[model samples]
Target: MKPEIAVLDIQGQYRIHTEFYRSDTPQNTIILVNGSMSTTASFAQTVKNLHPHLNVVLYDQPYAGQSKPHNRHQTPLTQELEADVLLELIEHFDVQYVLSFSWGGTAALTALASSPRRIEKAVISSFSPLINVPMRNYLERGRRCLADCNRTQVGNLVNDTLGKHLPSLFKRFNYRHVSTLAEHEYAQMHFHINQVLSGDPQCYLKATQRIEIPVLFINGEWDEYTAANDARQFAYAIRDSQFVSVENTGHFLDMEHKQASHISKIALLDFLKPPAPVITRPAQRLSVAL
Candidate 1:
């Protein structure tokens, strides 16, 4: 890691933490926003592997990871604010591509919604489409669950919710690694959830349709509830989108699957490097798009 690690002020309102991976030249610039509970370290495989030729920059999303907390007591910083930060960072570093996972995907699209012209190609992995049916219902339950946070409920959340997609091998896995994060980090993570689950509550659906950049969405096949089917529904709504369903993986495609790595290398890389995509609604709408 020959790159520098530091933070830059964004209009003096918010701070953007940036990490430049050395070796990867200026061929491609990817701004990766991890999930609510994750950070740049979680995406180490991609960041290190795509280096020398690809300038991969990963940052903390709002209150998650190592980012500064919100200025006010707001659950999530405005999607517009996130976009503004991304535009500033992109312009500063000349970034054109992005890879978003989970909540970060929502943030990425939200940023794109606010400023469609800032990004060119985006690879969204195992992201939440925020569909009205499942999204609302699950989130409503999650809020109630958090209200009564206890060991039993936490265990249930891990098992019934997060563990629903994993194989039996994961059932026996130790949770000590999961509990390693500090208290503030955990609370901040919950704060990020409020952003993802209920943040922009009044405008989430509209934002999804507003995405104009060419997006490649990759979803796992065996994910319990959040799987390729969910990604397919997300693909239908977006005007210009591509969906690739991983055959033998769960929700954690980046870590659990091998073919996904290949997809990023071959198909994903090919699509990203070329003429820029039109940054608005497509010229025409197809019934079975993406």
Candidate 2:
């Protein structure tokens, strides 16, 4: 299938945008979700490499990208609400498999635990049981960066972590800020992060324990965002799951390694070979919706 951008109506708002790409062979459909403050662009290139076997869909999480905003007058998107958004995407795309990154991984797992029968297969990355991991360091850094309105440090932090000594690439990873976002948008990004970190480990532990699906855990050997230890711990919680750490790779595994036939693909290929279990429903935002 060819690549096309499509928007799905959810709860009367079409603010959330999805980039839909189908595989010529249609091996499977994977509904991909971006992380906090990130957009669908994160998974753009991966769709191309996966086009041979997967109809990949990448979408903005509500209130993060060009998607819906969280109104102070209304409710913020909880794990429940986010899970509902996942369900809407699945039904719209006829998705049977899910691929999520960082923050989105927790939400994806929450959906699995809530609606065990709906998720057939999943792959989560740079994501873990945040409750178990000490999120204070990440939260503090992110908070200070936002408070100071320091996109430069925020940008440099990511580049430095992933690129290590390479200084040139920091701006590239900060596409959402350095390029796409405005000053006001940066503030919104911070606010979103605050909401996520405020609840911390306690909020997500319950969500993490609820996952009961075939899950694949992946991390970059140098993933500063989601540590290898965190990924391994997360994989351990899900029964019959595999954890893989890409060598010489940073947080941006799909991008840095898109061209090379890396070991990550081996894990992915092996996972897809097994038949997915039959699903029944979902953990939608509307908790009772399922």
Candidate 3:
């Protein structure tokens, strides 16, 4: 089904571009939150798996994808801001579940930590709440490349580091996408890197501990950007959560060139499916009338 387009106004902050894929027999709603360098288009494969089961909402954050900034003056966007946007979208669409990838998971968790109006469950992939030393160093290099205004270097840096573990096709695709980013996108990238650099692990732990809903956290076995160990640690903090580490996969699990993507997609579909209805047979009775 063709998704209906909508724009969400976050008061005076910024406007978001949203696409709603309404299920034919909708039971509930789920929101797809994009990563730092990712757009709503990144969730194409994901949406396909979910469209049949639940109403899906896809959106781009400000200065990313189709979403534009509010003014010419460049204001650094924060995870807090992204979290607020998620909350507003939740209220607007009456979303009951969240499925976020990469940095988008941070914002989604932040929103949940703040005590959202309503959320039943959440699933996060390729995300780690805390940025450890090695991860911070890797992110710092990207920040430096962005500071130098060398989009090519920025793309190469990721490929040389995290993308090296990804499948060949996905690596080439990522390089091409990043190297060709528009000028405005660099500004957005800078903000995202800064957000990661400035993130406090302690706060993230607190946030993870505070989440009340059931969660499913998935990470690639070979993922260096958001290591499986970190993802597992955070998942353990939640009262009700499960962690799955996909073998032979890297940061980009669902986009892999091999069966890994299919494996991850199947796991996602299984998790997001609504509970099956119980069919109780009724008692038989004899008719009194002849």
Candidate 4:
């Protein structure tokens, strides 16, 4: 399904590029939030699959893709700012569900905690509110590489870390893309890593505690980047949250290790799919011909 494209102006400060995939029938809308370094274009397949069942909204966050910040003053994208932008979009589009991946979950969680009236349910993948020690180390390494203008080191860092358990071909592709990042892109990376490093655990805890809607948190069993245990802890903080670990997988649950992708997909779809409407037949009046 082709999406209706639009550029949303956020209080006239910046514009975010968005794609709306409407279902044949009017259905509840679900927003697909991208992870760091990912864009709306990456969700092409997802939009196609979901548009048939639900209205899907895909947008590029500021500094991520087409959502470039016009105001140079607001250069770096912060978690709070992203959350505010997401909330505005939710209100504007009347979104009812959310599916966030990796770093994208940060904004989703924050928005749901702050203003969850419009969001009934959410699915968060490979995300943890608190940054564990391993995650911090990886972030710090990536930050240093960016700071030192060693962009090429990013590929090796990721291959040896987050992408370690991914397929070899995926590792090569990841390396090619990440290792050759442009100067401006590297700067954005620095900002993202720094924001996470500086995040307050207490703040995340409070925010998660505020969440009252049902949420499903999925993480790879072998994930060391975000640490599956940490993701479990984050899920535990919420009043209504379920945590699932995809077995034989690493940070990227979609990598299809031992059919992990299939498992994760099934779990997500089962949780997100709205219940089928019940059909009832009117009782026929008894024939009173007698």
Candidate 5:
């Protein structure tokens, strides 16, 4: 059966659009966060795979999918704000693990760091703690194209930045999604991009340092935006985080490559396995003293 969609009013300020998939025999609850431009729909397959063993929650950010519309004025949605929304959802659903993709990783890490006791494990995919020069340049170009409302230029830039790296089949899908974005959606994405560019990389790194739960960093081996080295650096910052590079994968590890998707699922399941319960022995009566 399909999951039910719901809206959460966060502190009466933000309305978060979410989908919840309940498992018959739930072991843990996973909160899935989509990338900057993507929505909860992007993770349809992932939720299906995890639903048998876990109760999964998928949500769109404030400006992103079915959530409330936002524009340039809301430019710079701070990671703290994003973390706040996510924390509310976690508390509502009693989420135990968080799984984030691309830009969503920032908010996930922030929440985990701020409230270490609330989460048990986290899996971050295709995210970089620090933005590299090439990625910055690409984002800048995309922003300029978007500002000018030049669809042709935007398409060309996206192709040059992302399409060239993806396989032919996935490239077409990527282009279709990018080309069809509404103007408000485009603006929202641009605002997110700007926020990421202006963010302090050290903050995310420090957040990782403060995380005590198990963290799994998954990156595509050939992802241009987030290099493997950057993923490794993020893992290194966390005390005992694990890093996995999906072979022959690009930015969209779960969607583009089946092997990579399989690997990611395995890693996630292994990391999220519930710890053995500690058995406590009952105290002996005072008969011995008598």
Candidate 6:
């Protein structure tokens, strides 16, 4: 069945454009959050892979995709507000699992912290708990390119930072979407980077300590923005989380080569499976008189 598009009012302040793929007998619901400068389309393959067994939810963040455009002069966006928006969607769908990529992972972490029990499990891929030096440098360059309205530079930055990781066949596809991003979307992406960098560096680290649900961190072995070591450290901080590295892949594992994508899908499917219900022996009847 075709996905249905809908709008959700967030605290009456913003409207999020959401897409839902329903299943007759879904094992669980998976909400896929997009990365910076990306839309729900980013998860086309992922949705196709999981729709048969899992109900999928996709949405555009504020100033992204079909959502309202952002104003450059508006107050800086906060992860807290982003978390609230995400939590609203989770509550709306009664979703148990969340799958977030790249920038969206920050929001997912924040949401998990805000409502520790709302999510049962999460798969965070190509994301870091905190911005590392290399990521910081890349974002700084992107900010300059966007500030100058240098589309060429912006395109190059996107290629070097994100596209370089994709397989040859998928490079063109990745570039096409990056090229079509609106100026407002670029601005919003930059704003998100700034918010994450400026906020508590240990925010996600601290959140990991409080989160009770299981989380899985999937990073490409060659991911430039989020190093394998960093991903491992982030996963280690969480009480019940595991880290997986997709061999010979980069940041965009979901859209990487076929083999990489397949591996990622399998990992996600295995992780999303609900845990077995705990059973205990029935209480024994009281003995006579004991």
lDDT of each: 0.63, 0.66, 0.82, 0.79, 0.79, 0.81
- Which pairs of residues collide in candidate 3? none
Please give, for residues 1-290, the per-residue lDDT of candidate 1 as tens digits.
Answer: 66677777778876666787744346667787776556666677677546655777877655555564533334446555666677677777778888877666766777777654557788887765544464455556655555444334444555455446554554434133234444444555455556666555535446768777788887777665456666666655678889877777766664554566665556556667675577896588659858
Candidate 3 residue runs with Cα over 4 Å from true position: 69-73, 167-169, 284-290
Whichever of 3 and 4 has more lDDT, that candidate is 3
Give one digit per residue, the lDDT tens place, for model 5 in 116-143: 4668889998888878887899889888
Q: Write the number of the candidate with greater TM-score, choosing between 4 and 6.
A: 6
> How should the candidates be ordered by TM-score, best one leading?
3, 6, 4, 5, 2, 1
Quality of model 1 by C-alpha lDDT: 0.63
- The candidate scoring highest on TM-score is 3
Best by lDDT: 3
Clashing pairs in 5: none
Candidate 1's C-alpha runs over 4 A off are 68-80, 130-141, 148-160, 163-205, 275-290
lDDT of 6 by residue, 29-130 (tens): 889988877888889888987887899999988777777553222554566788888999999988999999888887888888765455789988898865
Indicate the worst ten consecutive residues by lDDT in candidate 5.
Answer: 68-77
How do the residues 25-96 of candidate 3 rate in per-residue lDDT, one tens digit apiece?
998899999987778888887887787788999998887777855333377677888899999999999999
As for candidate 6, its clashing pairs are none
Count clashing residue pairs per candidate. Answer: 5, 7, 0, 0, 0, 0
As for candidate 2, its clashing pairs are 1-23, 84-284, 84-285, 113-210, 117-279, 117-280, 131-201
For candidate 4, what's the RMSD?
2.8
Q: Model 3, 285: alpha-carbon shift in Å? A: 6.7
